[model samples]
Target chain A: MSQVLTIDGKDLAFDSGDTLFDVAQAQGIYIPHLCHHPDYPPQGNCKLCTVDVDGQSKCACTTQAETGMSVQTDSTTLTEYRRALTELLFSEGNHHCPGCERSGNCQLQATAYAQGMTYSSFKLLNPQRQIDASHPSVLLDRDRCILCGLCVRASAQEGKHIFTIAGRGSDSTLAVNSDSGLLADTNLSAEDRATQVCPVGALMVKQQGFRIPIGQRIYDQGTIDDLGNRRPQYHSPKSKTARIAGDSDD
Target chain B: MTESTTDSRSLTRVAIDPLTRVEGHGKVTLLLDENQVVQQARLHIVEFRGFERFIQGRPYWELPMVVQRLCGICPVSHHLAAGKAIDMLVGAEQLPPTAEKTRRLLHFAQVLQSHALHFFHLSSPDLLFGFSSKASERNIVGLLEKHPETALKGVKLRKFGQQLIETITGKRVHGSLVVPGGINKALKPAEINVYAKQMDEIIQWSTEALELAQGLYQADRKHADFGAIGSPTLSLCGNNGNFELYHGDLRVKDIDGTILLDHISNRDYLAHIEEEVKSWSYMKFPFLKRLGKDRGWYRVGPLARVLNCQQMDTPLAERARLELVNQCYPDQHQSVLLYHWARMIELLHCAESIQQVLKDSELTGGELVAPHGDRNPECYGIIEAPRGTLIHHYKVNDQDLVEEANLIVSTTSNNQAMNEAIRSVCRQYIDGHGVSEGLLNHIEVAVRAFDPCLSCATHALGKMPLSVEILSVAGHETQVLERTSQGEIQQRFYPC
Candidate 1:
């Protein structure tokens, strides 16, 4: 009924269909991740969740759990590689934590904190990007986007189909699937799952900024390791009907 | 000091642009005549943030959060005002009793914190230390160094208010607690008990603070008249003619204490009041309709509120107000410096109200939020912010997306009054030969008396720091006074 896998020298059991990420999360083992929500299908776009399995580097989110597999999660090599990936993600966007409203709540920022990234090693790519406030309720800050496509995937899952990637590689950008290319034209409400799925501050709900006082945000309450339960409820299927704790204030 | 040469070229101008020790950015410009007489003075709001234009196309429900970004210092005022507006848009005028009580408590906390900040952090430095003390010494640091115990009490008092905000709204700067029809979360018994305990200390500290402020005021009666000027007053009062901050009808009164306009609905503010936009400043000057622009310019904030209201609801504040009016001043205290006394009185009222609200068990009721109802096309929300009356108007489409938005913030209402006060102070103190730091401080005292929020008035984009300059003629720069990052005033004489 269940299979065993040795992760970081600890034996853990998994079901036949469970991905390596599911097994680690179920076993209370944290493999730093971004672009990998439990409710959504596994996507390996972000290579930050990579782990050494049987002497081969595999993405924990997309890779299926196998029997008797020796996985090295927190090894020095893996830690260094994950740090570089997080650093690369940081460099690719303007991730100014102090200025960003989503600093404490952001999964990317939380993952970077978990990876012990005190500082970014890569050169800063301070790309000049447009902040689209045309939508009224939501602000589309392209500068904060890391191209994870979480909003796109979440919207498609909800049958909204309002978000999509429009280009290839570095040129690829998140585009609203509307003729006007603005959120106002779409039927996106403030309570949409797509609005909650942003790993960064890219798709922010306006006026909700700076509401959560500093020194008492998600990270301030507990480390990411202990704050897994407090993540944005985009992963919950009933999120549409479920009243978000802070959503009502806006 | 030697008399300056009487020539247009020799005349000097003093500018305190990006005024320090207050929220947001504003500047005071004084022009001296050829005879060394002060000709004119103006307070210019230099920043403009077009939030009304940019908020179009947003869902009406998001307005509370969207508008609160206008000023960091008074986000709660905007947040609650926007929340009230959205409540009207959603057709929920009579909110649940529990929700009403909760919002009332939140409003009290906001007033307490804002007043604490204004009195302790911003104004107390000038009051505690002599106004003409060293630029570096007449600040919070100086207060901390000289009066550490008093400074600590102020800090703790401000913290208590912020802590109350955090307890209710979940954060202080821009708490996302209040919604369209009601608040997001219900108060827990544990949270209520904690605040109830803390209120005792807060009340005690506030009482002592009132006593201290009165003593300070009495110490320098002459200096208190630095910015005193005669102006008509406009404020909001409760339905029963009682002092009100959260909800009220707009009322206007003349300089001689005669009621000009009475019991006007806030929704019809545009019909009763008009804004005159001047080319020299970004802030629009608001004046009453019947009196017209020339005589209609009126003062707001504590001075106006105290003068217009018949009674205060709280006992401690009522006694304080009676004592203040009967002994220290007349029925309508026109002196700008009395604002400090009125502010302290209101602070005491807020503290007592906090206690009164916390004791009520209805605050912990189960109904935390109201169900969404049919939407309206347009609505207006008005509330008395800490500085003065604030108004937010929004028009929405059938889909509930914001089509147009307009805001007449607290500081904007006092723009003409502030300019008039500055003109009066300049004429009284400045006698050419440029201006001394002491006189400039006196000029700043006039503007500070209103406790203006230039950021909310101008709604400017990005951060603005304070700086002052003195110019001769049109093109020639003479002197500059800039606020360093440490908030100390730095003097620089520019080569002509």
Candidate 2:
């Protein structure tokens, strides 16, 4: 029997083992997530998709939908929490939006805009990060990374196992699995799912930046609420089989 | 601080800090003796932003977009200049015809809008209402209240230019259009058509604005002598020695219209140009290396371009240029006020050029980027920004990150000339008078004629204020007068 749950006062039906996020997404309700991609196993690292389930705040991406469960996807308290989480993400890294190639198309930037986050109130860490551009077709700028692990999962799913998260807590960073710690030594190609799954400018294809123009960019057309996880795909010569994240079935 | 000029009389220092109606923060100081005779005058730029150092260790391709942060008023100029430099870095000696034309179009729009803004909004009040008019009456708001039609036309003209930039570059300010070897996108015919339909109105408005500036200059005899100083002028000229805003060799002309240097290439700029660091100001003084610092100081911008170039390429601007030349009998063009007239003529030229470029079929369809050439370590991008000549020089290491960067912005190039202009104004108007509103306005008017961008010159960022401090003969603070960034004036006196 199909399980029914109440989300934001709407009764939604879901199958067994389906997460609250997946059920809401299937019913055309966007939970405003960054690290949670539909194609990959929900990591629930970014708690932006926090919802009040039965008077308890929980990560919608990890919480399984149950029969007769009440879930509030959005509220004043949840918005404040989401905004604080977004601000913390910004303050934890050096995110210079103007200089970033993914400025208008970045999901992090779009999500921040949707949450009405104009500036970060927390003290910025300004952590120094590394840039790995050894790969001819792709560049890895750790400064823009949010530790989404989408790339780590995507690379593992592709059987390349090129990316892995290293360190812990505030020191955690997206690291390459190659022995030399360089992207050139990895088996990842520009067409690899790992290269295509980056939600930010962390893993960008070389020579394809600022091509879509400003107003025509993914987020520029509409807010993240209106266009959830839709990115303008730039097809490189070697990117014939590359797919945009959340667009194709796993 | 005050200095004793003679046994009986001592020099009192008067400073106008944070000069108003300009892009950045700067000040002017004059020393007066007991007789109220002007002893010395200097323009001080107060902040420094080391942009060249900031770009170090970054990839070379990012220079075009990265350098736009230098100035909000003229980011397009920086973008294009850096693009030209990056083109050389990637070994693109020649851009595709379409790429070249598109860049030119963007530059013309930039110049058009910048000139309109300076004239209609920044300096028009002084010209229309008189430089010595009531402080409250000499502003954009005042202009709008009295002359709404003219103010509206100025706004629309500036809007047209900005919209044109947005259409081409995507965003109005700090937008990305130029890439390494060429532009990122082509100008579609529909986009061209949108601007093409507005060309007639744009040209008409520009022509009317030019007439207003000319009429104002002719009507006021005082303008002829206001801040007049003799100096050598510099700008870029076409291969044939015609007025060229984009892609040209350097040309320098003396006060007598003698060519000091001509056809100097961008790569050889180091050999011809050099910057001198001064103890007082963050801005550097750039002059012709051949002439040395004492004599090499030259003027730049619309006045310099008009004086240095032989003729304008477009017919309308050429006619206006000739009229200006005829009005300035021999040495009359040396008047600082002529910058407004020359700037309006260039505005007309840009308007005509924009219309001409839109008709070009190459913009609709052609090769976007040029084929790569042998990569080089060092390259220079030089272009005539709205204010004056802008130079961007960069050297990249083997890893493609920028190893070094040196920029000589337009305002920095005119630093020495601005000081000279202020000195001339002090000697002419403030020689025997106390610090009055009219006298202070005269000083500001002199500096405004140059259309200086202190922010771009210092590579700094912040709002600017105007303050006047009177120092006693003993070097003790006697009185202070300040004009805040919000245009509020506060005066304080200290008992000796």
Report chain B TM per candidate. Answer: 0.91, 0.94
Clashing residue pairs for model 2:
none
Model 2's alpha-carbon lDDT is: 0.82
Every prediction's TM-score for the first chain?
0.89, 0.94
Worst 10 residues of 2 chain B by lDDT: B455-464
- Worst ten in a row by lDDT for model 1 chain B: B455-464
Q: Quote model 1's TM-score for chain B.
A: 0.91
Model 2 sits at an interface RMSD, in angstroms, of 2.9
Query: Model 1 scores what on Cα lDDT?
Result: 0.74
Q: Give the CA lDDT, 0 to 100, for residue B232 in model 2.
A: 81
Query: Fnat of each prediction?
Result: 0.05, 0.40
**Candidate 1 chain A least-lDDT 10 residues:** A235-244
Q: TM-score of predicted model 2? A: 0.93
Cα lDDT tens digits, model 1, B171-290, are: 778766666677766678998999898887888899988888778887876755666666777888999989898888888878777788889886788888899998878889998887
